[model samples]
Structure formats: C-alpha cells, structure tokens
Target: MLAGAPSSHMSSSVSTSQGIFPTSRIGSGESPNSGASSFTQPIADMNENDETDLLSISWNQDYGCFAAGTSHGFRIYNCEPCKETFRRDLKSGGFKIVEMLFRCNILALVGAVANSHYPPNKVLIWDDHQSRCIGEFTFRSDVRGVKLRRDRIVVVLEHKIYVYNFTDLKLLHQIETLANPRGLCCLSHHSNTFVLACPGLHKGHVRVEHFGLNVTKLINAHDSQIACFTLTLDGLLLATASVKGTLIRIFNTMDGSRLQEVRRGVDRAEINSIALSPNVQWLAASSDRGTVHVFSLRVRVSGEDSLTQPNAFQGPALFHQNSSSSLDPLISPNTGANPNSSLSFMRGVLPKYFSSEWSFAQFHLPEYTHFIVAFGSQNSVIIVGMDGSFYRCSFDQVHGGEVVQQEYVRFLKFENRPK
Candidate 1:
C-alpha cells in the first residue's frame, strides 16, 4: 500500500544538496544503520567532444578493472580504489559496444553496428598487456551482444547465437532462432544458461537456451516486442519488459512459468532498460519518459506447506508500486503510488538525449541524461548522459521516500562537443 512520503527526515550527516563537488565515504558492504549504499570518492570523468552514445560499461573480473564503449569506439580502464585512465582506444564505430570482458589482461570488446559497410559484423579482442589488438573476427550478421563465460564466449547476432572457445576465440556451436532478438543476457551465475529476448514476435517467443547443450525453451511471452530483460544472479528469476510501454513480466527462469507481472501504463513511454539488484530480489526499470521504477517481491507466509513445496508460488502480481515515500520532497515525484512521487516525474533525471551522471551536478545548466550502467556486488551505478558526462551514484540507505535521492559525484565529462 501507499504510505505518506516517509517522514521527510533527512539525516544531516551525509545529505548535501548544495556543493558543486561533494565527497562522502559510506559504510561499505551494506550499511547497518540506514541501509544506505556507500561509494568511493568521486574522481575525474572521462571527457569526449563527440556525440558519444554509450553502448555498455562492464567490469573486468580478471584484472579487477572496468571498461566502457561509446558510439565511436571503446576504452578500457582500471577502476580499483581509484579510477584509472583508458589504457587504449579501439577506434571503431562499433555500433552498440555490446559487451566487455577481461581474462587476465585480455579484454574482449564486442558490439553491433548498423552500418552495412566497413567491417559490418566483427568481434575485436584487445590484449591490454600488450596494448594492441589481438584478434578480430567477422560474424554473419551484426553482432548484438557477447557474453564472456568461463569456458566460452557467447555471441548473439540478428538471427543466430554462436558459442566460441574463450581461449582460441574459435566458434564452437551455432544456434539459429527468431529474427531480431533485442536483448540477450546470460542467466546463470555460473554462466550456463542464457535468456534471449525477441520482442513482438508471434506465438511461442522468448528463448531460454542452456549453454553447452542443445536444449532451448521457448515461451509465448509478452504482448508486444520484448524490449529489455535481465536475470537474477542465481538464475532463479527473469524479468522481461515490453517495448510498448504496458507492463513488465517476471517469470520462473527454470520452467518458464509466469511468476508476477508489473503492469505499466500504455502511454508513449517505452521500457528503455531494466536492472536487477545485486541481491537478486529488487528490480529497477527505466522508461522512455525518463522514470526509474523499482520493484521487489516480498514473500509472505501464506501457509505452512507452501514453504516446502518445490513449485512454490512466487508472490502476488503487483503493478508499478511506488516506494518514493523515503525521498526528499525536493527531488520526489507527485504521482505513482506515493504522495511525494515528484522524483519519478523529474524530466532531466531520465534524460531524452543521454543518460548518466557525474561527480557534480552542473547547477543552473540543463542536463542531458541517457544511459545508466551499474556493477559490482553492491551495484555501484554510473549514470551516462547525452552530453558525454557520467556520474557515479549510490542510493540513500535509511529512508523510504517518494523519490530516489542520488548522492552523485562528477566522474568523467565526455566532450561530445561537435567539431
């Protein structure tokens, strides 16, 4: 149910809305006090002058670093305690830098380009140790995404999915299915299964393919095109949002049963992106109208036997329940399930041109927000804006407000400045 915006009680300790550059060290590994997320210090943001469309930002597990891809090319960085500069720039209009993976010092950068000519479909693997391109291979169609598994790298094109050996980068097995799968995510935490999202196809859509084996499960899911999807880290739950701005459906990743459906409005808003929390319980989805809707399934005790059953009912199907009662009035939205729903209605929070935030909010100036990418066990979110700026953010811990309070710091400023 809707509760009055949680007692607008702002803790004066870490809350600040005035500084051009603010710094705070949060208690790491989940705060015991307010449940707030702590982050590292805000450093310099990677700046670019061109219209840099952010494709993807991924963490390198092997070297414990991070990398990002934009419209023109891709850059690799070492993001340990401090953010390091880009090791090298692989200059190519690698259309949506789909995925970035690091093994030891080797970083495999893969993305899809819409351009028909000039190396139409290819995967580029760069050796970060040598700081040079090691291998580049062409695919059949535009490569949509590439998942780096322990033993294999799964590549998704327009109509086919290829699993290749990670060491040699050689194609092992190829699977063909529907035409244009919009989004692809590896479901298994151990990297065994993958969830393929193909929006707006006819009956029996949405493929759940078990990697290394030839078994595939297809379900007739969603009314319109499946725009975006993400799986829990344990591969227990799968959330799929529609492109038609209706509702997001969460399903059982194992048996393909419809678990819960979160009904969204049928407005012009499109489900742009969806992200699952590191704990694999809560879900955050953003729309084309620039609102971030967060949902979580709370399991209640229905009966005694319900707990032990193997086919346990997940939970009730609640639609777009707002939890902004804990946000400050200054940033909260006025609609949704909360009285202080103003935060979800803010225009620039979900930028039309771009998405991302940096260390400091440019006061008085308009912001172009675009993409928000998150990482790590704690889900450190980096908001990337259209103007080529990115911000690092952690949600407030203690309060439940109508809006999401972002203690963001300027990280990188991309020049997307026209030449």
Candidate 2:
C-alpha cells in the first residue's frame, strides 16, 4: 500500500527581487557572464519592489525557457544563462500560473485568488506583443493548471480537462479524471503527434489519448496513486512515479507496455517532478529527498519493432533508432548503461529491489524544498526550486556518478543598479 496521498498544487509565499539581463538563446553552453555588458532593460520595470511573492514556476514546452508566476505578475527567463527576458506587472491582479508556448508572445495565465480582476476560475490568453488578453476561458470550478501548444490550449480543473482549438477557441475534447489537485496532465509538443496523458478514474491508472489515431489506452502505471509523471516531446514514451516515490516506470504510450523501470531510493519520498530528454535517451526525477536523479533509457524505438516505433503508426520518424550500434548525438556511447545489482543475474530468485536499475548520476540539494527539473543541452540538467534557487549541472556520462555543478544562482534576488 502507498504511504500517503499524492501531493497537491505547490505554492511558495517567499519574496523575490528583480534584475534585467541581455536576452540570449538557451542551450548555448555559454557562461552567464560571458557577455554581461550587453544586457538590455527588461520589457517591464526592473526597479519594482522586492516583496513580490512567487506563486509558481513552469518550464516552457522545449525547456529552453521558464515562466515564473509572481504575486505582482509573471516573468520569463532563459534557461542557459538564467536571466529575466520579459515580465508583466499588473496593477489589477497577479498570476498563479503562466504557461508559455515555446518562445512566442502568447501565454496562458491563471490568476491568483488574492485578486478579483483575474479570477482563479478563468484562464486569460495574453499576447505580450499587444499587451492585452487576446482571449479567455471560464470554468465552473477553480482551474488547477493550464497547458499551451501552438495548436491547442488545455485547461485542467479538479476533476476534468478541457481541450480547445487554438485558432477559434472551439472545444475539441473533454475528459473526466479522478480527484487531481496537482493537475497532473501532459501533452506532446511534437507538431505531428497529438497525445495527452492524465490520471484515470481509478487510482493508480493512467488514461492516454492518441488524438490522431482516435485511440484511448488505459495503463495500470502503478500500485499506488501516481505522484508525478512526464512524457517525451514526441509523446512516444512516458515515465511515472507513484506516491511510494522509490520506483519510476517508463512505458510506451501507444501499446501501454512497460519499457523500463529505475529506482530513486529505498526510503519513501515525495517526487516533485519528472522529465525525459528530447531524444528520449535520458530520464530525470526530483524529489523532496533533496536529490535529482538522471537515468539512462534502454528502450530503443526501431522500425523493425512494430509495437515500439511510433512512426510506424503515425507520420514522420517520431523516435526511430537506426541500428543497435547507433546512438543519439546527445548521448555518449559509454554512458547509457545504468548500474544494476550484482545479484540481478539471478533472475527471479530474489526480491525486485535487488534486480532494479539505479540512477547513472545524481545532484544533491537542500531537502524539504520543492523543485522541478529538465534536461539542458550537453548532458546538463536544469533545476528550479520553489525557494527561488536555480542550478545548472553536468554529469560525466562516461563515469556515471555525482554530477558537477556548472552554475548556481539565486534567480529571484534583488539587485542594485546604478542610476
């Protein structure tokens, strides 16, 4: 049996400071200070008071940037150099959630309850270029989360999820789910594939919808209630963690088949987030245990495997492997193998724990703080904490051990500028 209930929506009431920096593309592997003097003023005021409360933080579809919702408004930051690019401070209200669609000017905003102009039951589609809300969607209950894609807008309520066409805001689909206070839902960002995963009506079950194929598959993802899960950009693979938080299982979304499983630890912990690399070669998970783990994926999507290749059923080479010897450019040949227990060879002779695979690399942080993680370019992991901490670390793919910290910054701190 699981030890506890799944976590609910996370929010922090801590103060934050603002600073401006030059806008640059993420995943460049460049130091934050490499070109400091070229920093430009932010689109919004940088000299605003430092007492703003951080309500939430979410990564963009590509993980190249992140949106931070504050009591004052919301801000977007580039991932690589970790600098604020744009922000909006509203006199009327604050945002509780800000979901970005890549780097475009369109964003889906959910307002904090403290303000009345922007209600918690409404999602406002804001276009930064026009500096106004382009559209809005109202719900009967408070919205739990919002997801944005170029073609669709997903709104998550406590017990339902609504999908809408981006162009005309026409309702496309609606799904009923179990009580999900965390708003646990994920959608494929790939242009060709449209897949959505959310909690099913039963505990420990996941409902996956393949819109293109018009198929729905229910996966018994775990024995306990799911705590966290993530899908690859193509939505071909999914990784899930239960409230137990020790084991993370990966599955093929098309056939509902288990592909791989990795262990986070023996003790129980609250999983904060899970992320899969763009190439579907690596998986990362963060927990309340104050650690982030990266594991290598062994499942290969080959054209020969009819059940595993998403491209065989859909269009384009969604996630196909050329050959057994071929490796993704983002992965090193020596690093893909995760460490297995010596007793693993004894197959079925011992308990599952002895035969499970473990993380290839790990990064430590202060325990008790909520964090979200994502893969950055060049085998680096980007971590953002609810306490306003930002970290960039690289792992020795060849060695498979503790990761090296590349950069660390208190992103939400006050900065003094010359008048």
Candidate 3:
C-alpha cells in the first residue's frame, strides 16, 4: 500500500539526514484549505507555469504542500490559497512517479522520460533544500511506484517491492508479486503503523502485511484482477476494486473479513482510483468511463471501535439506479457486458441485481472521465485531470443525489507566488 497520512501532519524536518526545502518557503505556511467551502479564483488572469505538462501530483498531508510533476521537474504548491512556493525541474525530461516523504526534504522520484540523471529504473531520494539526490536505489525493471513513511521508504517494481529504512537506505524487506504495472499498493498509518496491501501471487487476491506485527494475510478479494485499492487513514479498513470496476469492496484489515461493498455501476468499466474519506464515512472513486462516484459508507460499531461484521453486509448494495438509465436514449443500456469491455467476454449474464449497485453521486464530465480523485475542503471531492486541470465540488451531506459541481479550477493557469 501507499502512504496514508498527509505531509501536513508532519514537522519541518523529516529526519536528521538533511533540512527541508527552504528556498521555496511561503510565509508561514498556507496551502489550499481542504476544509474550505470553495475557491473563488480569477481564472481569467491565471497563466500556466513553465512546465508544459503535468505527469503526476501528490500532497504531503503533513505539510499541506503538494508537488506537481512536469516534463521539466516538479513544483511545490501550498494548499489553502494554492500558491506555487517552490519549483524543481528535471533538465533531462518528465518525471513519471513522485512520492513525498512525511514533511521531510527527502522524496522518491521514478519513471523519467528524458532525464538521464534519474533513470526510469532507479528511485532517486531527493533532498529539496540541497536540490540534490542524497541516495539512490536501483531495480532490475522499471519502477512502477514509490512510497515514504516517517521511518521507511517503499519502491514498487514491475513484480517486486523493496522496503528500506529512512535514514540509512538499507534494504529492510522485499516482496514479489504478479505483473503489477500500475504499482498498486497502499500503506496505513493508523492506530498501528506500516500496514500494506498489494496484489497477491494469485489474481484478485490482496496481500495485507502488518509491518508492525510482521504478519501477512492474503484475502481472496475477487475473481478478476485487482484494479486499485486504498486503506482508511488508520489502516484499519481496506477498499478495493477489480478490473470489473462495477463493485468496490471494503474489508476489515485486522482479520481480512469483508466489511462492506459498494457498486460503482452495473456495467463494466476501468477503475482509475478508489479513495476512502478521512472520516471513512464516504468513499470516492473514478473510472475511465468518465464517472466519479461518492457513496455513503455505513460501518457498524459495537462501541468506540468499528467491528468487523462479515456476511451480514453481503448482497447487492444499491447506491443508485444507473444514472444513465437504459430508458434514456443518451445512456448506453448495455455498458457492463460490452464485448469490447476489459472483462466483458467472461461467460454468463451478470446478475440482474448488478444494476442496483450504482453511485449515489456521479460527477458528469465527459472530458474528465479519466481523472484522479481525492477528498477536499469541507468534505468536497477534488478532481484533477492529466491535462493539469482540477475541480472542487461540494457534496451535500443531508441531501445527496446527483453530484453538484463548479467549473475546473484550472491549476495550470493559477500560480501562488511566495512573498
């Protein structure tokens, strides 16, 4: 699994290794507020930064600073007012994956297109203040992803995972898996620490590792290949999707028991991402099909702790009837079983109840069908596209149905300079 806690939650210095990026300071510290009601920006005056394209973006929950990866390098932006306080560009080319360490200057960057200094097969641990890579780790194949916690660093290769100590860069542990090009992994910094989830040796199975306990469990999650997954903030709950994309399953991480499942849709689709809210009360997901669904989650509890209730939560759960009803000419009646769909050719008709599990709320944007999703200020959902555009939408808690949204914030056009 990837890192769960945010960089904003951390202090200025990550570890004794080096200082934080000081050249890119923004007054006291004001990134965009995740709890803001909405951002009313003057888009007409906004201008794109030097970087031409944004390949990846991630937030440091500990620092409230976000790094946007571009062909040149990456820039650090403060969230509240959303300003570009620091910028780092790769003279060689574009960076594919950018993983931020908790509030530390150290960051893991992989997947380079043009830059030779940082190769695609190597993970570069960069110290922002020094503007130099202090350490590097090599892999036999292309590195798919990298993750950082306060104490350790995780790198994901095509089929292998390597864990290293934060200060020494020592190889702590390594895992082998089936073909995992997406670098699907999640880490939970919850009540415990370093709980990880990734694809197992068998397809659709999830290997959950509690690093603190040195224990591992593989859950028979789905029959199809796992698409994407995420853990609750505390690492107690797990949410996963199969290539099928219609169903999203939640499990109790402690015992690998099914907690609950939500439907993304009745038809088959390619899931881009699945995220549980900070509160774990809501789940947001996006698919290449151009739909973002936010479903209300009900986690039953005995007292202060959420209990793991199996089988009782089973059966088709409906978030909504397909928003694009079959009766509507504009809506494709048969999306789940298209012969061209990724897993559509599998035998047998999908259960009629499949249509019942739909997204309670859907973001209808044809252009941003493939965008990445996150929860933002005031529990609003943040949608960012590959083209460098992002939008923030406020979901009504008491009254929820069709998703209500505003125009994209157009991050490329906006710039928050340090004073």
Can you write out model 2's per-residue Cα lDDT over 237-318, one digit (the tens) per residue? 7889999999999887877888888999999999999987755667899999999999997765432223333431121243
RMSD of every candidate to native, in Å, equals 17.5, 10.3, 12.0
Model 3 weakest 10-residue run by lDDT: 310-319
lDDT of 1 by residue, 325-388 (tens): 1111122131122112334356467532122111111111122244443433343443333433
Error of 2 at 247 (Å): 0.7
In order of TM-score, best first, we have: 2, 3, 1
TM-scores of the candidates in the order shown:
0.61, 0.82, 0.74
The alpha-carbon deviation from the true structure for residue 256 of candidate 3, after best TM-score superposition, in angstroms, is: 1.1
Q: What C-alpha lDDT, on a 0 to 100 scale, does residue 111 get in candidate 3?
A: 53
lDDT of 3 by residue, 256-289 (tens): 7786667777779888877666545578898888
Model 2, residue 239: distance off in Å is 0.7
lDDT of each: 0.44, 0.76, 0.63
What lDDT is reached at residue 318 by model 1? Answer: 17
